[model samples]
Structures are given as C-alpha cells and as structure tokens.
Target: MPPALNIVPFVSVDHMMRLVLAVGIERFLTELAGFIEEDFRRWSAFDKTPRIASHSPDGVIELMPTSDGTTYGFKYVNGHPKNVRAGRQTVAAFGVLADVGNGYPMLLTEMTILTALRTAATSALAGKYLAPPGARTMALIGNGAQAEFQALAFRALVGVDRLRLYDIDPAATEKCVRNLAGLGFDLRRCASVAAAVEGAEIVTTVTADRQNATILTDNLVGAGLHINGVGGDCPGKTELHPDVLLRCAIFVEYAPQSRIEGEIQQLPPDHPVTELWEVITGRAPGRRDAGQTTLFDSVGFAVEDFSALRYVREKLRTHPFYADLDLLADPDEPRDLFGMLLRAGAGPGRD
Candidate 1:
C-alpha cells in the first residue's frame, strides 16, 4: 500500500454489478431511498443548482453538481434515446465524490446503473408521501431500460405489487415483461398508454422522446393519480400535457431548476408549485385527500446523487469490489515534488 495516502478507489462496471448483487437490489433500493429521505430532510444544509446541459437534436448531456459543507459530488451523464438504433444504451454515466476539505476525489464509480437505481428510489420515496394510502397498482408507461427498476422500487418502497405496463414499442414492453416475470408482480402489458392507466392508482410516465409529447393527457389521468414523471428532464423534453400539469398538485426537487427541466417547465414561471423537501420534512401538505392528484416532477437533482455517492462510499468499507488507482503525487519532502518522479527512474526496479 505504498500510495495508501494517495490512492483513489475506483468502482468499475463489473465491480458495481458485484456490489449491487451482493446486496439484493430490493434491499439496495430500500436503503438507498432511506439515505435520500434523510438527506432531503436536511435539504437546507447543502448547495444545489440546476444541472448545466448541452442539448442536441440526438440527445443531451449534463453535469449535475451539489455539496454539503464537508463533501462535494457531481455526475457526468448523457441521454440519447435514438442511440438504441445503433444498439447503444439511451443513457450512460459516471460520477465522483470528493473530499471538500482537501479537494480530492474519494470515489469514482460507474453511474449508468447507479443512476437508474437512484432515479427509481427517489421516485418511490416521493410516492411514499404523496400517493394515496394503501396504493397498490402503478401504470409504468415507458418500458425501456428504466421501467424495470422503477417497478421494483415502487414495489419495495411504496407497496406497489401490481404493475400495468405500456410502451409505444411492443418489443420494449416484451422486454420489460420478460425481465419482471417471476418477481411476484401482477403485470399487464397493454397496447396503449390510456389502457395502461385504467384502474391504476399511480401512473409513471417515463417516455424518452425528445420533445413536448403528451404521454399523459388531461383526459387520461384519473382524479388521484400519483404521477412519477421522470422522463421530462430537459428544457425541450416534456411528457405531461400542460393541462394535466395544471390540474395536479405538483411537487418538485428544486423550483428554479424544475421550472427549467421538470414537467413544471410546461407552466408559466410564476405558477405555484411546492418544493418536495417541505413535504418530506413536514412543512408542506402532500395528497391533501385521496381525490387530489399529485405529481413528483423529478429531474434527477444533484443532492440525490450526493446521497447516492455517500451510500456507495460507505458500502466500500467491507466490499472488496473496488480497485486502487495511483491518482495523487506524494513526495518524501512536500516541496521536493520533482524528486519523486526523478527517483522513480533511478529506483532499483527502473528499466
């Protein structure tokens, strides 16, 4: 351990899969949601801003940054739904957690999978506070990469044992159904989004189209439908109809950011919406009655990533699914920085 003080821990894709499988996905999502809830409770203690995005006709890439006074974190992620035509994933990502006191990264890990996990966890966490009591069925409108994770998270955290799935592509629906079978889910693969929403207490619109498409129209949403709107996460990309947004009691991660990125972006800037932290912290009302509709306008905020990074770092203590990288400079004398590199060539092992 020559670089014990300078080594950085890296969790590659294989290692992340091992770590997650070792801890069951349900248990992992449950614990991760708990961490998210705890951080949201102390929401005022951290720094947050809208993610910076570079948009394109194909897709978008973003950098989401956030920090508590003691630690800093950020994620580099991209969304290219059309990439599937080339057999590529719609989203790929990685993130870093750094020591604010020293300004060095303590963890660098693959976030493509982690992002799916966190997004599901955060959605279910919001549903816990906003969904109607004893809610069981959820309509998962987009059966892409994220649909399976969202179903499992709702099952684990919000008691959604039944799922009604619909996707524009029946192949995608087949893929979701195939993956979720034997998981104790009462699943229905529907041909239309409207048919999927029938009799379901919750409706989650996760379509990845890059425009203002109406995945959930005004007439489609039921009176008390708890909407987990996760796909409308960019400036030009939105899923809910504007009228649907107006009728629901919208809750957002951060108002300023959500106004630009979340479904609330469809409404005027001055339209009132509540910050979710207030409801989680008991300062605001959630689902005033079973008849009132509620929406969690999630744009995948930086604070949730901060909490996710913290969770992985803690799990690293006993989890050996990490490799060390020599990422820092260390010298016998703090001022003799050049000597370290010079000695490397002069050492016994030098070629």
Candidate 2:
C-alpha cells in the first residue's frame, strides 16, 4: 500500500453540496441508510462510546469517536439554536476518518450536510422498521435545515409522501414548504402540533431548542404513531412529555448514549427500551401490531458517522468532490522531518 501520510481526501462544504445534488439527495439518503444498516448488523465489531460533550449556556460542542479495528472515525459538532437570530445555522460539523492500523488520517469532510442526511436516513430507516406498513404521511414539527431532508428521506425510504408541518417561526415553515412544495408531498401547514399530528401515522419532532421543552405531549400523540424525536440531544434538552415516552415503545441507536442524550433521560434508569440494531438484525421486534406506537429516540452516534465517512470515501474513488490535502509531513528519511523543511528553504530562492 502507498504511504498513508502522503495525502488525505478532503470533502469541503461546497463539494458536499455539489455531491449531494449530483447523487440526488433522496438517492444519497437511501444508499446511506443501506450502509448504516450493514454496519449495525455487525455492531459488535466496533469500538463505541457515548459522544463526549462540553455544554455551555449558548450551545454544546461534541466529539464522537469510534473504531472498527481497521478504521476509525470521529466528528466535531456544535449546536447553538440562538445562532439563527444572527443568520447562522444552528449546527455546524466536520468529521475525520483514519486508518487504525497506522494511526494516519485518511479523510476529512464537512459533515454539517452529511450529518443532516444521515440523521434523516437513520430516522426513515427506523420508521421502515417501526412505522405501520404502507404509512403514507408524516408530521414534521420543526421546519428548519433538517426538515426538508427528513421529508425527502421519509418519502424515499418509508413511502411517506404527505407532510404536516408546524414551527414557531412561520418563516421556517414557509421555507420548508417552499423547498418541498413540488416534491410531490401533500404539504399541510398546521396551526399547532396537534393539528400536524392529526391523522398522521408518523410524527417527527425535530425542533432546535436548548431546554426540556415539551414539543409533543401525550394528548397529541395518538395510537399507531411512529415518533422520530430528533432534537432533544444534549443534557437538559428534550421534546416529548414523559407521558408520551411512557406510552410508546421506545427505540434508540445506542442505549448507554441515548439514555444520556435522548428522550429516555426523562425515564427511570432501567426503563424498558429496545435497541434499533436488534430490530434491524431481527433479534428484536419492531412494531408489534398495526395499532402499536413506536418511538425512535435518535441523538446520533459515532458508528453512523463512521459509516457515512466510509460511504464518502468509496464515492471519492469515482466522484471528484474530494481534494488531495497535505495534512501530514512527508520526509524523505522518515525520521528526518526537520531536514525536509530545511531542504525546502534551501532551494534556489532561499534566504
């Protein structure tokens, strides 16, 4: 194999957006979910941990790291809901993939867009396993940067084509509606969360807030609904009322981690919850019956980020959105690192 320090493949924000458009966002999501499922099937092979976070009054910065023996990956992400008032995205992220054998960085990519894509794909994938079969509609409570991605992912993966949306800021809802208007979804702008969830088989709460906000209460949630709670990710931040969790069959990406960052934080430590991987692997049941209510408490995980990075690495082989980044110093004598820089300065134009 070639030396690992020679070059790194870097996928920037513009490149990521171009790649998403080139591959078509829906298709990309569908493919990315396939990758996520494949990794989940062999979940035992990975070295995992709950993301390490530093919380503050403004937002939270997190580091998610994991390894599968041969390869390793981690993401740096931050969430600040107040950023929107200053015309900034509420979340920004980037990730790295490295060869575990050599401990050398291999890929670095902008993950803000990729994170949105994987999150939606994972939600839709969980829906496929948790939602009622032939479910055709979903209520998206937070219509922000992630709303459209969730809408398209559901439409592509769960066969959902109708969306009911509600956001405190009408402009956010308007942006979501405008973005997805002609995407074939039967869009409904609801006056309230209850209105959005009415007659909908699946409800996705993706609001961005930094508190224990009850975006969904027991009264709003009816039987047979699959709820995708996406935003209650940091400590002291949650969406559903405790009663809603008590009523639904909860599913999570990773138990130890989800219990800390997901909706289950409200429940007792030993509260019954199912792992989504078991459902994917057929080791556990997903939806028991047509009238069953299921909740996928997703706070995002490192394994999903690893899988996403792997997918992008494979794509870089054919697609050209990646750049060769000189991330590490390459020395002719391997140990003569100082000599290499000296040789460069010793060239014709040297001082």
Candidate 3:
C-alpha cells in the first residue's frame, strides 16, 4: 500500500510574528485592509454566523467560525478585563485554518497578536470610507494593548498624526504612550473621555470594561467627526450612548452580528445602520458630506480574520517555517478511518 499522507502545518506565534515582520507592519496592514475590502465586496459568497459565546462570572469566551466553500476558519478568544490583575492579558486568542474539501486542519496559529493586528486593520479600513478626508487627529478613549496598534494603523493608513489618549486606568495610557514614544506622533494624555474627544476629527473607543459604560455621549461628538467604536463587542456591553448612535451614520462590519455586539445594540432591532460591505461594494454611500457625523461600530468580524489568515498563508509561501503535524489519520480508502487507527498500532493496552 502507498504511504498514508496526512500533512498539516503547525504555525506558532513566532512564525506568525516572522510573517508579519517580514512583510513589514505597514505593508501587512495595507494588504490586510485590501483583503478585507475584497472579502466584504463579495459578502454573499461566504457562510456567515454570529460567534458562539460562553459567558462566565469574570468574562466571556467566544468561537467565531466561517467558510467560503474551499477553506474554513475559526478563532477561539477570551475576554477578561480582570485578567490583567493576574498578570495576564485582557484578551487571549488562537485560531485554525482548515480545508473544507476534506475537513482537515491546514494551519493552527496563536491569534493574540494577530487578533490585535486584524482589529486595527479592520478599524482603519472602515475609517478610510467613514472618516472625512484629511483626518489628522484621533482621540483614543481606551489605551490598552489594542491602542498602540490602532494608533499605528491610523498613522499608516488614515494620515492621523495626533493622538489624545485616555483610560480609566492611567497605567494603560502610560503603557500606550510608552509604546508609541519613538513612532513620531504627537501624544496627549487626557483627563476624561470628553477631553480626549475634544478637537479631534476621529474618536476611537476601545475600552476594556465589560459594562454599559457610555464612553462617548451625544454631546461630545462634533460635526464631521468619525467615531470608531471598538469596545462593547458583546451583548450587555455598550460604549456609546443611544443618542450618539442616532446622531451618526453608523457603518458596521455585518449588520446582523453588529446589532448584537456593536454599539448599535443600544438601538432597536429596526434601527438603521449601513454595512461596510455595502459601502465597499458601492451599494451604499459613505461620508455623504464633510459635516455629517460617521460611526464605524467595529465588533471584530470573522471575515477580517479570514483575510488575515489567508494573507499569512500566502506570506508563508516564500519563507516557510511551520511545523507539519499528524492531526488526522489517513487510510488508503476513505471508509477506513477506523482501520487506519488500528494500523497505527492502536491495540488495546498498547502504549
């Protein structure tokens, strides 16, 4: 019999890091943004579903899965704001890419850093359409691990040169500022969310608190401003006031999912919001006027991760350094799955 073939690549966090660094962060974000836009334009071709979530007393865990006929992907992520107190990150994540043809995993990767990168890329992609031209200053309401990436993405993609940073925990803001010190942007630590939003053309709320905290009130929002609502991505966790959502032309990744996780969750089921795919596909208008307020309620969609994974896989083609593991047993015959295990020396009492 021919040698059984079951090959899969184990992509570690380090491999993913090398992939990102090799392409350069800016190029990765730019390419990733393009991939996301392309995927959004073909929204109907994908199998979409809201992530399965498991809630706990401390925080929540979620599994987001999607497929596009050929490939399937899923991410396992946890959100625990209190984890930092235990010297852990507020979010921990990993994901897998699988071939839909035979239901075999092709790659497994740590997505903690990749998630951060994809979130920032998604935000910047939305901002490209929703934010007014010449947008320079951004008010970042929550300064956490995501803050620096958001800052860098905006600077690289949206011409953002100034950042007004604020967090309930001053240490988080300090960490963000320290991370961006040599990146060459003007930074200001704000005393309050309102102070941070003042005079800024873009406002990004990525707070970690898992509650109905109103980070952006209606009154604080200015004309012609774009708001990137990155926090409050789960049910019962909201960051924008109802009036703020009403005042802006809201653009979301996926409306059905966004209505449950984005800031639009505050509104009724019938509340009006534009899907980013519509804008990307030219089915809907974006930024009608310079004076109109725009909002991109970002909940970190699965398609963005799909795009990121595809981009990473393509990058690995040139500089391959991933492990191949036997995650699935292969038999010469398709119906011999059980027989393959037996052939692998799986007798009862055999070690």
Candidate 4:
C-alpha cells in the first residue's frame, strides 16, 4: 500500500535526541558537514536569499528558506539572549522540508538541537578549509550551550582537541568544562578573552551578547589565525572589531545576508570578500599563505538549514526515529475539501 499523502514524518525533541545518539555526535557532524559541502559545491543551482527577520527590543525572529529546484526547506528560529535569564534557551528553532512540486511538507523536526549541530558543523567545515594547515588548538570564547558542540565538531572535522575556553560567566565555563570532561580534549579554562586567544591557532567567538561587543580585538589576534565569528549574526550584534575585520582575509556564506548580520557588517559595502562556495568550488582561494589572517564571518545561511533538513530526511530512511503526523488534509477526492472536513466531523461519534 502506498503511504498516506497526509503523513509527514515528525522528529520531536526526544526523537531528535535519540537520532543524534544513534548516529553518534562526531559521525553526525561529519556526515552533516558532507551534506552542507555538497550543497555549497553546487551553490549556483539553489535559490538563495537573506533570512527575513522581524526584530524586537528583546530579540529577533527569523525565517530562513531555500530550495534546490527539487525540494524546499525553511527554519523558524528565534534568538533571545535574555531568555537565559528566564531559564529558557537563548536560541530555539524548528524546520520543515516540503516537496516543491506539490507543496506538501515531507518532514517536520525540532531544529533547536539540529541548529546547534549544524551551526557547529558549518563552523567546523569552514575551519577545515580556512584554518591553518594541521592546526590543533582553538580559542573558544563563548562557553554557552553551543560551546561543547563546537568543540566536538572541531575535533571531528579538523582534528582540534586542544581547546582554550573562556566565558564572561565563570559558571558557564565550568559547565562547558564539566560537559567535555573525558572527551579527549585538552581543555583550559581561561581568565579572559586575551588569555584564551593566546597561542591558539584558531579563534572561535560564539558569545551571546545582543549588542555590538568587541569579543576579539585587534591587539589579541595574530598572523595566520582563523577566526570563526558565530555570535554576531544580527545587526547591532557583532563579535569582532572592525579593525580586526580589516586586518583579515574574509569569507562568507552569502554577501547580502552577511553584510546585514555578520562581522563584515562593520566594513564598507564594497569591501573585498570571498564567498565560501567559491573556495569550496576552487573558483577562489581559501588561505593564501600560512601568515595570512583568515576569517569566516558566518551569519548562518538558509542553504545550510536546507542541507540539514535534507540530511535528517535521508537518515529517517534507515533510522526511522520519527513519528508520522497526519498534518495534511487528504480527501477521498482531490477537490472534496469540504467533504473531507464534513467526514472528519462525522467520525465514530455522530453529532
């Protein structure tokens, strides 16, 4: 029998956790990165746009959408740095993948977890091409919820197991350290951002401040370092100093979006920057020399979310850790929309 057209596979938070555990974190990150890379290599084939955002005083809500001509995907995400104070996540999300031909949703899943994983995976993937050759040490400046995931991904993708960790809140750093214990990481709890960046090959600033904060200053960064600026993703929320941006060779997912939300937002509109797709496709260079400072000013693009949704869809084929949700109205006849509703009302118990 054919599957019901109304059935959409749904991976709830529990199912998402089970799926991640079933696939193992490192393996999941590596495979997800592969999907993201494949999509990036065929960059021109997809429809791309900057995320549509609705900003508020508290935070922002965004819809990130993309399609590769065959399938369409989008993620509904929110960022409220103040939410942590209320015992809620600073970032939360969910996403859907739909068949473009019929406009039917194929999969629905919790992206709060997937977003963290994909974000870290994308950062590590960028690190793979942009970070110095054989680099093993990283300065992770933000020890929030995304910190451990970032550490795991860097190790999985780039073989970086030595981490210098720092956070404005000492407890946050302690949480990150405790979570990563016995994970084969050489972890050091640093006193300040400067201490964290000292002697590190790659520096990752994933802070959660919603203001334009100088997480990484020019004086702290040195030659040949790769900076993964992940936190400064919204306008008025940036991590690196403008002078630091000027000092480095920069790359981004999409120029228009990055200009509005990434660390490059501080730079002029005409500032020379390379797209990561160009580097992955060999159309542009990644790291020119060992001494050149490189930065991947990632603002989290729609295509990455598209790739992640597709990855989850593929895994469901074998893993099957999702529940089938009857999300669509399926009528006995294609045009009997009213009849379908009428029948639903007249089910086992008559009115």
- Compare the candidates by lDDT and give the number of the best one: 4
Clashes of 4: 0
- Indicate the worst ten consecutive residues by lDDT in candidate 4: 342-351
Per-residue lDDT tens digits of candidate 3, residues 1-351?
753367777778788788788888878888888888888888888889789999889888999999888989999999888998899988999888888997878878788988999999999999988898999999999998899889988987898989999999999999999989988999999999889999999999998768799888889998899999998798888999999888899898889998888788889999888999999889999999999999999999898888887777777788695778777767778798888777768555755
lDDT of 2 at 260: 88
Off by over 4 Å in 1: 1-3
- Candidate 4 residue-wise lDDT, 1-351, digit = tens: 877999999999999999999999999999999999999999998999668889888888999889999999999999888898899998899999999999999999999999999999999999999999999999999999899999999999999989999999999999999999998999999999999999999999999888899999899999999999999898888999999999999999999889988998899999999999999999999999999999999889999999999999999998999999989988889899999888888788855
Q: lDDT of all the models against the reference? A: 0.91, 0.92, 0.88, 0.94
Model 1 scores worst on lDDT over the 10 consecutive residues at: 1-10
- Candidate 1 C-alpha error for residue 138, in Å: 0.5
Model 1 agreement with the true structure over 1-351: per-residue lDDT tens digits? 364667889999999999999998998999999999999999999987678889887888999888998999999999888888999988999999998998988999999999999999999999999999999999999998899999999999999999999999999999999999999999998879889999999999899888788999899988988999999987888999999999999999889999988888879999999988999999998889988999999988899999999999999998878999778886788799899879988889744
Tell me the lDDT of model 1 at 347. 88
Candidate 4 colliding pairs: none
By the TM-score metric, which is better: model 2 or model 3?
2
Candidate order by TM-score, decreasing, is 4, 2, 1, 3
Candidate 2 segments whose C-alpha is farther than 4 A from its true place: 1-4, 348-351
RMSD of each: 1.5, 1.6, 2.6, 1.3
- For candidate 3, give the lDDT: 0.88
TM-scores, in order shown? 0.96, 0.97, 0.93, 0.98
The TM-score between candidate 4 and the true structure equals 0.98
* Of candidates 4 and 2, the better by TM-score: 4
Q: Give the Cα error of residue 96 in candidate 3, in Å.
A: 1.6
Query: Number of clashing residue pairs in every model?
Result: 0, 0, 0, 0
